[model samples]
Target: MNLSIDVTNNEGVSNVVLTGEVDAFTAPKLKDTLLPLTKEKGQVVEVDFQDVNYMDSTGLGVFISALKSTKEHASTMRLVHMQDRVYRLFKITGLTEIINIESTVQGGM
Candidate 1:
């Protein structure tokens, strides 16, 4: 399963929607897609993972790196509409506490 990222600008925020498998072989693509967005100062970025079917540690690493980059630029990064499996992974790994994860679009931070 190939990973794909679609980026769009909404108001002043950047919405990055990710789909397909994000594993060792495909996590780099996700990272590359998000790197530039995080470089800009005060840019709000939200990564929607509602359509993502699978992910691994590499994928989680990519998300963490992106979050760090956003912080360095004084921008905010969030994860929205995560699937149950993905949400569980975040919980077990303590990532849910470190990064904001929304259960639904209406509940985003």
Candidate 2:
């Protein structure tokens, strides 16, 4: 499947809305679009994963890299509105503890 990433920046925050899958084939695209935003000092990079229903380890790598970059640049990365199935990957991989993840669903965080 293909991956589509839409990014907008405002008030020192970069909002990324992702659509489609993030597997091996699409991870590079995500990395390209997200990592650059993390380079800005004290910036906030918020990614909406509500429309993304599928992802693999490669996608995790992209986020991990972005996280590391954010730390180096003093930026913040937030992943929000993720589907349960995709969120489980982060949970099982122990990333939920390190990454800031939130959901719009009631009782979710």
Q: Rate the local accuracy (lDDT) of all candidates.
A: 0.86, 0.93
Model 1 C-alpha lDDT per residue in residues 2-98, reported as the tens digit of each score: 9888999977699999888889999888888888898888888998888987888989999889888988888888889888777878889999998
Error of 1 at 17 (Å): 0.9
Best by TM-score: 2
Q: Kindly provide the TM-score of model 1 when superposed on the true structure, using C-alpha atoms.
A: 0.90
Worst 10 residues of 2 by lDDT: 100-109
**Predicted candidate 2 versus true structure: per-residue lDDT over 1-109, tens digit per residue:** 9988999989999999999999999999899899999999999999999999999999999999998999999999999999988999999999999999995585655
Query: Would you estimate the TM-scores of all the predictions?
Result: 0.90, 0.95
Q: Which residue pairs in model 2 clash with each other?
A: none
Q: Give the TM-score comparing model 2 with the true structure, all chains together.
A: 0.95
Best by lDDT: 2
Error of 2 at 99 (Å): 0.3
